[model samples]
Structures are given as structure tokens and as C-alpha cells.
Target: MAEVGDDVYREDPTARRLEERVAEITGKEAALFVPSGTMGNQIALLCHTQRGDEVVVGEGAHCAYYESGAGAAWSGVQFEVAGRGGLFTAAELEAVIKAPAYYMPRTRVVALENTHNRAGGVVFPEDEVHAIAQVARAHGLAMHLDGARLWNASVATGRAVAALAAPFDTVSVCFSKGLGAPVGSALCGSAETIAAALRFRKMLGGGMRQIGVLAAAALYALDHHVERLFEDHAAAKVIAAALRDVAGAWVPAPETNLVMVDTPGIPAARFVEAAERRGVRVSAFGPHRTRICTHLDLPREEVLRVAEVLVEALREANAEASAGMGAGTSAGTVG
Candidate 1:
């Protein structure tokens, strides 16, 4: 059913279907499909700003730290970083706008990441989102949301994705991550902005022929894979609780799917390598931090088993998950 034609001409039926579905879900006027979340974000940036304009982003946002400098390289723009966990307040956002002067680069956009990746999957509070959106609007700036893990955010927060996305001028969401699709993301916005993004996409070689195969997979994921994200969140909390008990290790409770574990005495690389040897894998973030993401691939039983395996591995390495200085959190939320 997904046999497709050239998408550059917007002739691919399934691709159009995906775009329509995404627009409906995000409550935007239109949507465009891109090959990846990075492309979706860059395209939004490219369409929203001119050369030398500045985009405000979170301190540890993917656009700031993880996108290979594409914002500066491809968009020909600079960034003004604000806030931790990728959540900045309206005052913080408004304060960063440059004074209107010929020498100053105009602040053209404010970008946000939901279920912020590097921050232990913290969901951006709805109040903060609206407040910041108001600031962006007041400053005559566009807003772009990098909602790559928004499905997880939505499920965890008990909010509709549309509600979370409503305040932004444009929003990008991924189908490949928690949604379980092979590849693809969508950027939703006004028709004008999406039209502009499409040109940028073509300029960046993001146009495709016969992309409906992937679009079909993405559509399937929307129907089948979005509802149970809470299971992953639950699994992450379980692992975090277990990790807090490991000697010399403290883990931040996760809001969504990703867990960040801190090992003060153990090198992160050593811990990751040791865990891998025991068939338990984690992402090394720094010398002392490791990131473990729970997903559909890891079931509840597997999560508990991995926790025990991690404890055992660390015990063998003479490293236990110790109660750190701040381990007595009531919310158990650290990072």
C-alpha cells in the first residue's frame, strides 16, 4: 500500500497522509516529513531565521550540544543558551533578546526540547511552555519545539500532544524513537512555514523519492506504539530506585524513559564497559555519568533483571551504588 512516487513534487500519497496525521495531532495548520529529528529541527531553524540571526536554546539541548553544529553550519545562525534540563522560563527567554541595533544579531527563534534528553528525560512543565511562548511572541520571535520524545512526555504527563504543541509556531516530533518506527520525523507549523521548510529540506538533500515505505511504518507506530510509554517510564523509576542503593552510585529518578546514573568513585567508561560485559548496556555521558534508556525493547521483567545484573556487576567491580550526599530526595528526582 505504500508504493510511492516522488515526494519532492508532493506526489507521494502515504507521505502526504503522514504529514496530515502529524498536523492533526500537533494541532498545526500543516506538517512536513523529514528523514530525521535533526533534519526536522534544522529545517525549522532554516525556515524561521535569516543568516546571522540568533536562536535561543536550552543549555543542554540537542540543537546546542548534539546536532553537530548544524544550527551554525547549515542555518548560518548563532545560539544563546539558557536554562538547565532544557527548560527556560519566560523571563529568561525574554532577557536574552538582543536590543534592536544594527550590530546585534536579531533573536529570531526560541527552541525547546520536551522530555529533554540529557536531563534525565524531564518533561517541560506546561506552565513554563506557555509562559515562554508568550515571551517569544512578545519579542516577535518564532517558537520551535523539538518534541522528539514527545510521545513519552505526553504519556507521562497525561497531556495530549496537541496541547503541549499548541503554543509553538512550529514543532517537530520523531516517529523513530519511542514510537518504534524505523525512520522519520515530522515538523508541524503554519502552511507558510512548512512550505519554507520544504525548500530548506530540498536544499539540504532531505527530499526523497518513494518515502512512503517509511511513512507507512511511522503511521503504524502512531496507532500501535504511543499508548504504552508509561510502562517504560515505570521501568526507569524502578531502575533508578535500584541504582540509588548501589554503593558509591546515585541515580536521578526519571520522568520519562531515560535514567542518568552518577558514579562518583567509578569512571563512567569503566562502568559502561563492565556493565556491557555482563550483557547490560548503558550510554556513557561523562567521566562520572551514564545514561540508561528504557523502551519497548526492554520489558518490565527485563528491567528488574538488568537492575540486579548491574548491581552484581558493580559489586564485582568493587563499586556499589552508595547513597550519595543528596540521595534522600522525596521525589527521588535528581540529575
Candidate 2:
């Protein structure tokens, strides 16, 4: 095991190296290594906005719905939801930007997600990001990217991460989510922004002593794991196609390594349980929806196996529901 070094004082070589590499990749002036994606995002928000300010975010974004309202709880900032299903047009953003005369909370930042999770891993088109960035600039709002799956988007679109990050004031990238790193996230931004965020990070109890061991894994992933993302995306597509043909289910075309499937007639929990029984693990996001994610450790063959398990699971659930309906019909007749 690697020795723990005090990271709070900036003496951790591994953390420092990871931060530098993140800044280089994103073409930012500086970077800070954080413990998790949520912390990176919250710290970035804290750096950019005053208390009581608001951020414009997609309704389905991870920060808005998944981060447990930490932005408001920690920073006293609220969200102005932009659109449904994580899709927001530049015009929609323009309309939502707050005017100075209004007593409403000022929209200090526009936050976006790449490979939006709730949107079936949809890649927010590069042109769209640029357009939204332009809108943010026009309104003097800071732009932040919840780029947890940015590497997936970059691989799918063949766009450089730096080019994609250019329009935003800050971006948070995760190494653990899909990159196979055990733990780590990087927040990249201008020197001033990172300096400001570091203070907030310490305040939030994110200061570490020595994190080079984790940083080492992140460094390894950035160099060797990035290109392999295409394999994950391809596997997700295969899984989605397989699920689409299953009874009582519909899977959208995958844009990255996430596939969202709807079990129209079967309860989501039942579907998940069935899949788990067959040795495939997935998450139920809603009453009728499940999400499957592909990652570095998941091999292509395993992905196919998951698909097979999913198909069988759906079939089993549908059959059970049909049998129950038949039982109810017979009972009614007997009654």
C-alpha cells in the first residue's frame, strides 16, 4: 500500500500531477484533484457564484437531480431548470437567463452535462455546447460542464476534450465512473477559479494529505483507458439493440456507454430483480425505466451476456404478469 501523505498542504505529488494533467487536457489554466465528481461540481459552483445566486441546469442533469441538492444546501444557490429530459436549446437558455432588475435569484452559471445520464447517455452536440456558451457569454453567466462521462462523448464524437471544454469556465471530469480508476475527479478552470475553488474545497472537508496513489490510477487511465471507451460505447449499442427486441421493453439507440430501457408493462423493480437473479446488475431509475452502464472492467462478452440476461429477465417478468392476469380473470369468473 502507498503511504498516506498530508494532501491539505498541497504536498501530495500524485494529486499535483493529476491536477496538472487535467488542466493540460482541458486547456485550462489550472486544476484541482477532488475526492468525487459531486464535490468537484459543488466546489466549482461555490467558486463561481455568490450565496443565493442561481444556476441554469437541465432538469435531468446529475447535479440537479442526482447530487442531492448540495448546491443549495452547501452554497445557498438554487437551480433554474432549463428543459425536460436533459435537452436544452440555446434559445431556451436565453429566455431563462435572469435580468438584473428582477428580484429573482441571478443566474450566475449555466451548467451542462456531456453524455447526459438521464438522456440515455446522449452526447450534447459540440455545436450546441458552443451555442449555449455564446448565450452564457452574452448574459455574462459562467459556464460549467458536468463532464463525468466527457471521455465517452469525446470518443464517440472524435472531438478533443480541450476543444469541447474551451467554451466553459469550468469542467469536472471523473476518473472512477468509467475510466476504471478506483477513485478521483478533477476540476479544471482558470487559475483564479481554481484558487477560489481550493478554498471552498478545504471548507467542505475535501482537503487531503497524500492522494498520489489514487492520482496514479487516474493518470494511468487518462493515458491508456481513454481510447478504449469506444469499445464500451459499441457494447452499449449492442445491449440496447438486444433489449429493444425484448417483449414489453424499448431501448433507445445508445450514444455512449449508457443504455436506458423502458419496461412499459413490467414494473422497473421486477425487471431489475429478474436481471439480478440472472447475474446481471443494473439500476432502476423510475417506475418503468432501467439504466445499464458499460465500463472499462466490463468486457464485450460480458456485455453480451448482460444483454442475454436482460432479455430473459424481461421475458420472465412479462410471463409472470400475464399469468397473474390470467389468475385474476379465472378468479373473477369463479366469483
- lDDT against the true structure, per candidate, is 0.85, 0.85
Q: Which stretches of candidate 1 lie over 4 Å from their true place?
A: 317-335
Instruction: Kindly report which residue stretches of model 2 are placed more than 4 angstroms away from their true locations once superposed.
Output: 1-5, 325-335
Query: On residues 98-128, what C-alpha lDDT tens digit does candidate 1 reach at each position?
Result: 9999999999999999989888789999999
Residues 58-164, model 2: lDDT tens digits: 87788877777898898899889886789798999988888886688888999999978888889998888889988899889999999999998889999999988
Q: Which clashing pairs does model 1 show?
A: 246-320, 246-321, 246-322, 247-320, 247-321, 247-322, 248-322, 249-322
Lowest-lDDT window of 10 residues in candidate 1?
326-335
